[model samples]
Target: MSVSLNGVGLTHANGQVALSGIDLQVSSGERVAIIGPSGAGKTSLLRLLASNLRPTAGQVSLLEQQPWQLSARQRQHLRARIGLIHQAPPLPPRQRVVTAVLAGKLGQWSLVKSLLNLLHPVDMSGAAAALARLDLADKLFERCDQLSGGQLQRVGIARVLYQAPELILADEPVSAMDPVLAGHTLSVLNEEASRRGMTLLASLHAVDLALTHFPRVIGVREGRIVFDQPPATISPAQLDALYANEQLQVLPAPESTTQASVQIPRC
Candidate 1:
């Protein structure tokens, strides 16, 4: 198995409970999509699974090892085997895209090699190939500040592809993309995960995209999991209940034909 969470929960130092009583298990090569309304603890759950945030309750076992129980150095080594894709990648404004992509291997590279690569990106071809998969090959030499939000997101994904970790955790990865581009980009991501047999878990606001791309879907609300089932078995009512806060904005409609236009939240 790739990961197991036994009654996992997280509470901030300020006494804010981000998640509680969550239980999830995923095996190697499984691709699961997490769907939820904003502030529903999706980000917290992914972060917790990635070992970026420790749980306040329950146990988390990832890549067959308990992260909290491991020594700091051991934990650092464990992190090298995982790839995290942020919704908004924090690339330095002055950094080149090639440098940013090559930085993905810094955890595995020797210190001297890392320093040399920083000076003049050693794996330009490798970085270019990763970018090409996302239709950003031409931007290899571009500066981070010169790209738009969607382009930056692709760059972030390119970095992960270059990293080729055992597990992939993405949080709202395609939020900035146009509908067509979003669909295409997700296809690219899913294809890569399948090809490499990487365990993939992503949290997405686009429910249709979640259903179309992932075989398994988990819905979360109020810091708790509402449902975890195969996409074909998930009913419209369950999805409705998961996003049932009348006070909040309703989720958007399916943006493109690539996404199945069925059973979505509405005002």
Candidate 2:
């Protein structure tokens, strides 16, 4: 099993409940997409899986180990096996793209090697290859601040690809890209995950993108799972209920780009 959550709950220090009773399971090499409204606890779920957040209740298992149960040092080692891609990568503004990409392995690298590589990248070829896969090879030496949002997102993905972790968790990874590029990047992610037999779980705002790329779809709403089904099995009525917003009627996840989008409220 790649992930297992049993009645898991998370309440922040501010006392805002982000998730409650989130019971989920994913097999090894399974690729799943999480779709939901903006505040539906999608990010919280991913953070919980990434070991960035501790659950307030219930049990959480990642890669067969309980993250919170382990010692801090042991948990750090466990974290090295998981690749986390954020919506906006937390990279230094003045850092070069190569340095940023190479940092992906710092978690697994020895202290001396990590420090030396920070000063002078030891494996420029590997970083370049990863960037090349995302069409960012030319920007390798450029500072991160010089890149566009979409470019930065790709850089984050490149770092994960280079890291080669057993599991991948991405949160709204392509929100800044154009439709076509977003589609392409997702295709790349799916391809890489499949090729490497890496388990992938991504929270996506683009419902069409989720339907197009992922075979399994999980619908989250108001910190709970509304439905978990294949794209073809999901109904328009179910979607309408999941994203019911009182303010304005809006589009539900379309079956395909060619199909007319379903009408619902804002997610």
Candidate 3:
């Protein structure tokens, strides 16, 4: 299993419950999409799987190992085998794109090599190749600040592709792009995962995109799994129920004014 969550629950330090009873499992090379309304614990769940947060209750197993049970050093080693694509990839504004992409392998490289690469990108071709896959090869030498939002998001994905981890987790990976670009980016990501035989789990807000791209979709609401099934099995009624918003208000149309007709005196 690439990921397994058994009765998982998380409570923040400020005493806020983010998730509870999240029982999910993904086998190797499986592509799964997690969809839910905003603030519905989607990011929290991804964080848990990434080993960024420890579950207050229950277990989280990633890459066949229980992350919380491992030692700090062991967990760090484990992290090298996993790639996480953040929505706003925390790349340094002034940093060159090549350096950012090469940083993906910092965990696996020697300290000396890492330091040298930082001073001068030692693998420019490798970085360019990865970016090329995402159609950003021309931006290889550009400063991260020069790129647009969607371009930056693609750069983040390229970094992860360079990392080539066993498992990939993305949180709103294509949220910044146009519909066509978003679809293309997702196809690239899915293809990469398939080629590498790596497991992929992404949290998306686009229900139609999720249903179209992923074979299996997991719907989350209010910190719980509402449904987990193939796209074909997910009903529109279920989606309506899942996204029902009680706080939504419908505004009435503006009242029309009836103008009085004036009689023409010269007729």
**TM agreement with the true structure for every prediction:** 0.93, 0.94, 0.91
What tens-digit string does per-residue lDDT give for candidate 3 at 186-231? 9999999999998999999776668778888898999999999987
Ranking by TM-score: 2, 1, 3
The residue pairs that clash in candidate 1, if any, are: none
Model 2, 1-267: lDDT tens per residue?
Answer: 999999999999999999998899999999999988779999999999999999999999999999998999999999999999999999999999999999999998999999999889989999999998888999999999999999999999999999999999999999889989999999999999999999999999877788889989999998999898888777767766777763445564554522445544433
- Local distance difference test values of all predictions, in order: 0.90, 0.90, 0.87
After superposing candidate 3 on the true structure, give the runs of residues whose Cα lies further than 4 Å from its correct spot: 246-267
CA RMSD (A), model 1: 2.8
Model 1 CA lDDT for position 104: 93
By summed lDDT, the worst window of 10 consecutive residues in model 2 runs over 257-266
Task: Tell me the number of clashing residue pairs for each predicted model.
Answer: 0, 1, 0
Output the worst ten-in-a-row residue range by lDDT, candidate 1.
Answer: 252-261
Off by over 4 Å in 1: 246-267
